[model samples]
Target: MDTPNRLAAAVSPYLLAHARDPVDWHEWGDEAFAAARRRDVPILLSVGYSACHWCHVMARESFSDPATAELINRSFVAVKVDREERPDLDRIYLDAVTALTGRAGWPLTAFLTPSGEPFFGGTYFPREARHGLPAFTAVLAAVSEAWRGRRSEVAAAGAALARRLASPPPTADADPGPDALGAVYRALERDFDPVHGGFGEAPKFPPAAALEFLLRITDASDAPRAAPMVQATLAAMADGGIHDQIGGGFSRYAVDRRWLVPHFEKMLYDNALLGRLYTRAAQVTGDPGVAGVARTTLDYLVDDLGLPDGGFAASEDADSEGEEGRFYVFTWAEFLAASGDAASLAAPVLGAAPEGNFEGRIVLHRARPAEAVARDAGTDSAEVEEAVVAALEGLRALRANRVRPERDDKAVAAWNGLAIRALAESATVLGEPRYLEAAVRAARFALAELRRPDGRLLRSRRAGRGDVPAFCEDYGAVALGLFALFRADGDPAWFDQAGGLVEDMIDLFGDGTDGGFFATGRDAPSLIARPLNLSDHPTPSDNALAAEALLTLAAYTGEARYGERAAAVFRVAGRLFEGAPTAVAHLAGILAVALAPARELAVVGPAGHPTTAALLAVAEESFRPDLFVAWGDGHCDGGIPLLQGRVALEGRPTAYLCRGHTCTGPTMDAAELRRLLTRRFRLSDGERRVGP
Candidate 1:
């Protein structure tokens, strides 16, 4: 009945969830720091995002207690930060935390000096002492006493850690070469669970990046082992409880090795990345089942998480009604109540019983394959597919009536960009206009809501307000999305937007001293040091992705500047090739284009030209991000030289394939176009080389 505390007054849903906690919490900003300085006390910096499950537990057990709050409020200045909102702050602090403790994770509690120097940090602490860990109160008292009694020692230690963070270990150019792919394969083979399919012992993540890398390597080299790894991972993930069997899309991760139980949080990035991966796998293996999962995941995004404004929502929380997995898990009686005889067919496959895995319920999983299910039902595969479809349809409606996870409605520019790329790619593969429409709508939403008057873009928008100057990721992602839109829809405006954004990004984030883009903008607030991370996280880094976007734009528009800029970015990071080649996958895409023949395709005619439509279809259907297409009455003015002056052939639907300013004969036939595209572009032996 009492009024909630400071966090309740905050805008973020994650922060508001901890509003009622007795610990005096202040959102990360100047006020929190000023308070710490005024009290001359150390600060307890807690950094986490809303979707982190352990973060929730720590808040409920420790911060929510009156005693815990009193000690924290009395002894230290407590500041809470949503890492999603301020990634720059998170990066700096996380680096320090990792340096001091040799590990880091969510609900990260670090003791920092008033000036923001971190002394010590760790993850979740219990309300009372348990599991051989000190109690929250005891830890707080000890830290507080140490700060007062040994100020010089603590300061000296913090200073030393700061120096170590300031200068990371010197990296050598250890070009792991193509062998890095082999290394990853060997690593996976060593850790992979034979029965479950994913790597590691338990608490399995989808590891979409690793899977994607493998797919790329396999596709390029014609490696047989690569195909099976892709197949096994996809099959296992599709059949696991980590996937919502009744609905579409997957949960965050599996809590157990067998993929029987999941963490229950569904992220837009995971689904988007996995959707693209599965779609590609389906194409490679010629498996309809894999494609079905991809389609279903896309359906979930459109049906549930799609914003009317066109962007996808950030994530679905893991908890519902204060209980994790309650909304998703179902008991045998509950399953029967939802679907009568339909439940019988799924019961054995899903291991649903009177008592469930977590409580008295069952978390659905496919312990058997679709073929096995068909065999058990004594029916054809097609009949089994129909039955499963009917059962899922019935179950989805019932589940919709129950509680649903909280949706983070904030549309992030970078995440939406990733979703846009996924949707555009899916549109081509599935031949679905709806997906393309979704991609275009999201792109439009971003341009409308996130752009500033001066042409600068913002990082995120929530509840109709856009704040925070766009980071490198924001510019790079939105630009990449726009390029995809241009390819999918053949709108020249998308190309124009992408071009303008790239120019702006180069001006704002480009390292003048070197060449690659910095993570933060020139006008943004200064940190201890600017981090130029190229490693892939849930999404690729801005620098790496920007290179990809630039190369694509160049190929389409025929602007050598774009390609030149991409090369410049690679050269800047070339010195670290051996140390972190995987971080440079985007750069790899660009390099592939450079080494191979560069083709620019243009189809000109009326919007409804049958020939033009066929050529456009061919363009979209191909997995060649290196290729660019344009449809119009005229060629792009600053377009690629290969496409310049080329117009619609014979005033009918016609296509032109150009390489290096040389135009091939125009044709309206799809078969002829396919013949032109099928010709492989080989690299000269001398030209084939890695970056600096």
Candidate 2:
């Protein structure tokens, strides 16, 4: 029988997976650092998340090996961290590794001092020396020797890293303006792959923020190119293997330039961001195909990732049965055998061949259009479409019989927040009440199960238990999600709760002198440094999300201080904007909101009135990141300042529009409301303000 280690008590699924490993692994916390100090040994920080393929690989290759485990246990105080749960450690250590080796990814291998200062690190060393990488044991031996023999050198490295992290980020020469948006857009255009769509070369991520940024671009001069880029990329991804042709969600990323192959792990955050992106794309382009894709992607979340407790899980693993992509792929014969009735019809459209596309198995992609298939088969396009749907249903049922990938059933607060935001927004846009209900349930779950009695939020919930303190990202994201729910259903409670969260975020994560927010909360356990995420790599950075939530709250409540704090975040992120525009894609979106005219829309009407619904529809018809919608019968029941003075005009449903606190007359006409929203106007001289 295998012995369970200290990791057996860990809440992290990743840590639990290694519970039976012979390695003396400690969870990231005071206990691990204390043990390291007591033993006078360097800490071996191994950071990775549940869904990371290489993380799984390294675990199986090294951690599972008794010999390797014995060496690790003897040489260092091994610590395991789930990056999803503790992004502060991930960010700090990832930076340290990147600084040391110029590149980084999971599983992150870092040598830290007892106090948690990272000195030397690299990613995924092999068990045996191969592929230009040294063996894990050899690297361990070298680090151990350096710690014991060359102690001063190790200390110097730690001190240097500490100094670098403690230093303030460089500020921009001037506050960015509308011109900064153009500069970033131009940079994106240069990096764009015209023929294949999306930016740069192979291994394409969803680029959710960048796509949203492009969709939000309303400039007449840039619209032509921007629209095509957004549409083409969306269309390309929908047809690609990366989009889970049999299922309905996307994988982590494509392995090829054309998105023909994927890494196969489906992440909750990716699906959340993509669902919202596609829903908006559908709104912008008025394409039913895009809308259909949005529905499936959003539905995928509730059906597959949703937990029993009303929250969604973090991710689904990439590998099943010890083979990557095994669960998602099928042989051409297997596809044809299971396709049934639509086999011949579906084969042409599904890119199935006797010679498979990926390792003797087919990674299904839409190779041919339904129209083309119908024409060649001497059938109607409608029939072809119907056949394709039937074929997909058959494929789904067949795939269900296979050994499925394991789900990391950890419901992360920040990820659930992202999911809630997507579901709420998509519910309104797609007219799907179920999505709204899901969002509401999720928000309620977070508030009830993940919140402390002291009003602070927890980082995650697993098996109905949560103890990890929430970070800045969690606060920002959950606030944004609740705010979206407020817009969808006009529940002032959600708005008030959202506002309260933003307040807590300010108090807990705000760096008063430096501006912006830290990844960890104020009272959370301290590490070597307070980590800050400046780039939106996997999701919106901590500060970007905070700034967005802050700006949104400010627009609704007329709070000047909220906007001021958001501006400070932009200032803190100025260097990133100047050098790596693409990296700060989400921040650019927030910056656009900051630069544009503040649009506050309030509808005063009786509940369940058609005129009121119509007015709200106009506001939701297009994507306006700057617009904040408030609906009430007459008074601001939730203390939303935007709706305080709003009332039904002439005893009928009325819509009021405000730009920078300057209001236009109320209108009961939906067409007039649309016109008011679409019309461009300059702010008053007194109301005009400079950019963040």
Candidate 3:
């Protein structure tokens, strides 16, 4: 066994992967910076995650090479950072990298001063000069020379970057009104591919957040016109190669606009968001196809991404057997051997080319249906369909024996929170109890394992350790998860737990003088400056999620203070939301909740009553973004303020739809309650998308 480096003592799986390298790597800490200062050299900072393929390439090409390692060890202090573990550091440095290089990505290479300030950086560099870029060793030599010779210039750049990092971020010039959302939709309309369904040209992302935002604004009336975009995109993704045609789950993003061929990595957050997005869309439109996609995504999580301890795994590496897409892609000979009668019929249907598209192999995608393929091949449609199904099952079985993508076993708190919310909400909308149970199981595991006794949420759990203090997203998302659990089963304990988290979050990360919550706690080891990040990065933004947690807690507890704090948060970020509504889509969602003053729907009946389930189903199926639900057994005397004084009408199941502390009317008929919710969706009668 090789001697482990400083990173062996670290918790991040990504960092530990490099602990055996000869680069003399130090984990991101003051100790690394102190070493740089003592050695009188610049700090070589490299930040990447476990699922990143390029990070591995750099490790193999340069960090593992003794010559490169000796050069780095002699001339610079090498620091390796797991971006997932310390997003605060990632955010600050990524901003600087972008400011310096005009672009940024994983395997981020940056030159920092002894004091942890970035002066020059870029994404992946080759070991030697190639592909229009200088080699990594050449870069190290140049930076070292610059540090030694032109020390003043390097120091000036670092100081200037530090100042830029400390400056406040730009906000929206105006309040985020309906016009802001309308503008984003108009832009979406411009970029949406009429042929492929997703926005833009090649390299398409699912746009889950954007799709969900559209779902919310669908029909300031009963019929939402923006639905075609969402429907088209989902259908395109389902039929595309990016979705696992043999297994279940979609990939990270498509490499081509036609949704054929993907980056191959699978992230927990993407699936979670996609599952909830599809499930909610199904509930709104009653589309069985969309519902199926949601089911497939959730099942994939359960079957492929689950951990032994009940927590979900963070991600699956994009590579298997040290080759990217090997397990996922198939060759022509292999396909023919695997599928006999179905080979000819399925080949073209699965978009297999004669010459092959990906490194002499085909990346499978269902470009056409079995029926279509049968027509082209002059075969029976029924037989072709059956054959295709059989072939898929056989392929899946054959692939099972192949080495699988490395699973990152770390259960990240923020990502888990996203998972729990997805599962719980999908359970309600899909009427699937198993999904709800999965949500509860994850929530319990996160709370019990990732939470500190002092009420701090840890970032990730790996090999029975919960070390890193929770960031802003952890608090926001986990609290939201607990709130979802409470609503799903009407448990006061979950609500109380969520409420406690909200209070602690406020104490730790709140900005009393400013409006939005900071990205780190007050007690957090100081970076150059505390970042108040509001932009979305695949998942919802911290400020947006924070607003959601507080606003929801306010609705449940009927506390104006929590609501006021959320309002304060909005005051600061209004312009940012208004200008780039798509980037802050979740904030737009939460803001709608706040402006609607949020409706409270209380269903009171016996837990086991059949009538209760009927009403609950109605509540679940209805798309009420501005409303929160409280289910009870006619006993609302506990911690849930929204449930207080709500009772079944004449012992029959009843629903009370309240706005501020007052119920509009009590109804025993589920149909009547559904009608009331439908009315809330109408745009006429002065009904705004949110509040009037």
Candidate 4:
């Protein structure tokens, strides 16, 4: 029997995974470092998340082995960290790993001095030497030996890293303008897999933020390129195995370029961000298929991830029954058996090779586009799509009896914030009241449960305790979510809540000297140096989300201070905007929003008035990614600046369209308001496309 370690009391599932490991694993904190100092040994830090598959593989192959565990236990004080729960440690260590190794990925292994400055690290290692990499045991022996015999050199290296992290980063002169957007677009075009529909070759993530950037750049000049990429990527991902045909929502990423064979974890942030992008894309391109995809994803969130009260789970694990992709992949026989009458059409559409695509089983990806399949099956595309939807419904029911993947039920505040914003925004655009209700529930829960009375937001919740104070992303994203809810429902209290959260964020994460938000809060535990997050990885950066929230808040309140605060961030990370900007897509999008002329839309009338409701719906459904909007029914108490002097004209619903705080004459008719909004902004190339 294996002995339990200190992680047995931990809240993180990733840490608890090793609770029974033979190694004397310690949870990350001063206690672990104290032990390292007391023993005069280096610290071995392993960072990963619960949903990470490679982390599981490393645990099974190396950490679980008694011989390898003995070496780790004896030579160094082993510390386990879940990246999701403690992104600060992850950020600091990951940067050190990248600086030392030129690349970074999970199952992050770092050797730190007792004082907690990283000196050496790599990713996964096998128990014995393989793939031209040293064995875990061998690496441990060398690091331990160096710590003892070469103490002066190790201490010097640690001191050097400490200094490097402590130094402030140099600011860039360039602002992200049209020139920067074009450069990033051209780079994406160059790297885009024309055949597969993603930016890179394989291991393809959905590029959610980049797609959003494209959605925002919908001027005539950008549409020609951005439209095609957005459509192809959304279509390919929806048609591929990465999207669960039976269950809704998307897998973490496709392992292949063609969106087949995913890593299998379904993350709340991925679906939330992607749902917003798809709905926006559908509004822009008028693609019903794309809209259907967005709707399906939203429904999945409500059904699968949403907790009974309102908050959402962090992630669904990739592995099931101790095997990767086991719950999702189907045998050829099972696929045909489930299809029955439609087997002839469904078999070809589902890409079921006789020997299977992976591990002797079909991963259920689209073998060909539905249009081509329609041509071959002697039917129209619409009829084929109907048949395919029916077939998938049957398969979904069939798979219900299969062992489901494990779900990590912890509700992290930042991810729920992303979900809330997506759901609330989609509710207005997609005309779904249920989504709005869900968003309200989530926002209310976040404010009530995940926040302290002192106005500090907590990181996560499990069972009942909410202990961890929020990071930068947690504060920014939750505040943005509340802002979106306020916009959708016209509630003054939501606006008030959002404003308070933003002020708290500015107080906690804002860098007074440098003028941008840091990744961790002022109250967060001390590390070697506070990480300044400027890049978006998988999700939007803490800094960029803050910039976006602040910009929107400024527009709503007519506050120049908020806008000025966001501008300071642009000054610091502007070089990244010109160089490799697509990777930092959230920042790039916000910069465009700040630079472009913003339109504040105010509709004034009673909610019970028919004409006002119609005008509001039209404005709500329009593709106005750049618009700051408010709905007022003869009231200035809505708390939006656009509603301050707005009034209904002659007891008729009136629409006020303004730019740079200047409004046009009030219009009563919805059609006239539409025309005014339509005529307000013309494309740079003098070509007009439909929708806002």
Between prediction 1 and prediction 3, the one with superior TM-score is 3
TM-score of each: 0.91, 0.97, 0.96, 0.96
- The sequence of per-residue lDDT tens digits that candidate 4 reaches over residues 1-692 is 25688888888777788899888999888899899999989999999988888899999988888988888988899999888888888888898888888988898999999899989999988877998889888999999999889999988988898788777777777544566666666777778788879898888999988887777776645446777887788889998999987777999998889898899999999999988888888888888888888999988888899987689998988998898988888887887777767766776777876799888998887777678888998987787667666667767777888788888788899999999999999998898999999999999889888877776788998777647778999988998998888778888788888888899889989999978899888878788999888889878999999999998888887789999899888888777766767767788778767766677888888878899788877786667766877886786646567688888888788888887668888888888877877764644535333112
Error of 1 at 21 (Å): 3.1
Give the lDDT of residue 477 in candidate 3.
Answer: 88
> Backbone clash tally for model 3?
4
Model 2 C-alpha lDDT per residue in residues 1-692, reported as the tens digit of each score: 18899999999898999899999999987888889999999999999988889999998899999899988999899999999988888888898889889999899999998988888999999989999999999999999999999888888889899878766677676667666676667777888888778899988998998888788774434445778889999999999999988779999999889988999999999999999999999999899999999999999999999999999999999999999999988887778777878888887788888898989898889989989999999998898888777878877888999899999999999999999999999999999999999999999999998888888899998987779899999999999999999999998999989999999999999999878898888897666778878789789999889999999998998879999999888888887776888888888878877887789998888779999999999999888777899898875556888888777888899988997666798899999989888775443443223221
Q: What root-mean-square deviation over C-alphas does model 1 reach?
A: 3.1
Tens digit of per-residue lDDT, candidate 1, span 30-139: 78889988998999989887777778888888887787889999999998887766677777788788888788877788998877778988778888788986887888
Q: Candidate 3 lDDT (Cα, whole model)?
A: 0.83
Residue 35, candidate 1: how far off, in angstroms? 2.1
Candidate whose lDDT is highest: 2
Q: Candidate 3: minimum summed lDDT over ten consecutive residues — where?
A: 683-692
Q: What is candidate 3's lDDT per residue for 1-692, written digit by digit as tens?
A: 18888888877788888889988899877789889888899999999988888888888899999999999999999999888888888888888999998998888898999988888999998888899989999989889999999999999999999988988766555455555556556666677788899888877888987787777777644224468888889889988888998878888888888888788889998998898888988877788988998999999987788887878998998899999888898888877777777777777777876677788898887767777888887887787777777777767877989999998889999989988988988888887899898888898899899988866789999989858899989999889988998889888888888898899889999987767889999989978878988778777888888998998988777889998888777777776655665677667666655655467888888888988888888888867777888888886645688888777778898888887767788888888988887765333446665322
Clashes of each: 6, 0, 4, 0
TM-score of 1: 0.91
Clashing pairs in 2: none
Q: How big is the positional error of residue 677 in model 4, measured in Å on the Cα after superposition?
A: 1.5
State model 4's lDDT: 0.84
